[model samples]
Target: MARQKDAFYFDGFRRSADYACQAAKLLSEVMHDFNPDQLRERMDGMHALEKAADGVRHAMMDELVTAFITPFDREDIDELGRVLDDVTDSIEGVLNRMYYDNVTDM
Candidate 1:
């Protein structure tokens, strides 16, 4: 069946938040384990989550560029997207530091 476009207003933002949650959850998993032996493997998995989040952010931006009427101010939406991206990036950064510094213990 045909769908309605305006039926969903904050879908992009919701998806971005979902991505942030996923990244945070994975970060928690890696921190809890603190397994240096499998650090590379865990980082690889984190990279996948980061990339998926990036994809969602990029798609949202592209949609924003062509949207006629957003639920809120466009700048606000953009800023929110950036902030959420930073959150996921920061979570990934923690993993990166742990892997780089050989920190295996809590």
Candidate 2:
């Protein structure tokens, strides 16, 4: 049971981090393609990836709460989870701003 719980926590963290990295890569590609123009379409994909990351984060939290012992400090785990989520949220916000301002061009 303990090993399974540890695996779940680690897996969730890995998945979340992977999503963030992938989203950043996608956003970078969008920026490259759009150049100075706002990245509207690129944002759609970014948002999707962000949501995926959030899902993993929520799963981790849920598991954490149910487990009697965590491999790391609960606060640390929560903070790391939030930071990963923040990366996606921040990207989404940038996309939102570009879309609302009608500055998006490619």
Candidate 3:
């Protein structure tokens, strides 16, 4: 049981990292190819990635509440997840600012 719970946490951590990577790539693509016509669509895509990352973090929190065998302390695991989520948010934030501010250049 403990081992299984640990596996869940590990899987959650991995997924979070994957989301961060995807967010970074998306942000890069949007910035590299700035297009006013596609700004809305790009923002939508970034929002989706951010939302998905949030879900992963939320799941980690839910599991942490009941997890007895986390890789480290429960608070540490929770903080790690939050930090990972923040990374996605920070990446997404750039695109969001561009979209909202009507950035027309790199």
lDDT of 2: 0.78
Q: Clash pairs of candidate 2?
A: none
RMSD of each: 3.0, 2.8, 1.7
Q: Give the winner by lDDT: 1 or 2.
A: 1
Is candidate 2 or 3 superior in lDDT?
A: 3
| C-alpha TM-scores of all predictions | 0.86, 0.83, 0.92
- Looking at model 1, the pairs that clash are none
Off by over 4 Å in 3: none
Tell me the tens digit of each residue's lDDT in model 1 across 56-105.
78887887789887767889878988888888888889889988988868
Task: Between candidates 2 and 3, name the one with more favorable TM-score.
Answer: 3
Q: Report the lDDT of model 3 for residue 1.
A: 38
Clashing pairs in 3: none
Give the runs in model 1 whose Cα sits over 4 Å from its true position.
1-9
* Number of backbone collisions per candidate: 0, 0, 0
In terms of lDDT, model 3 sits at 0.86
For candidate 3, the TM-score is 0.92
Highest TM-score scorer = 3
Query: Residue 64 of candidate 1: its Cα lDDT?
Result: 78
Q: Residue-wise lDDT of candidate 2 within 1-106, one digit each (tens)?
A: 3576688877877888788788777766766676444355577778888888888998988887887888889999889888888887887776677667776466
Candidate 1 backbone clash number = 0
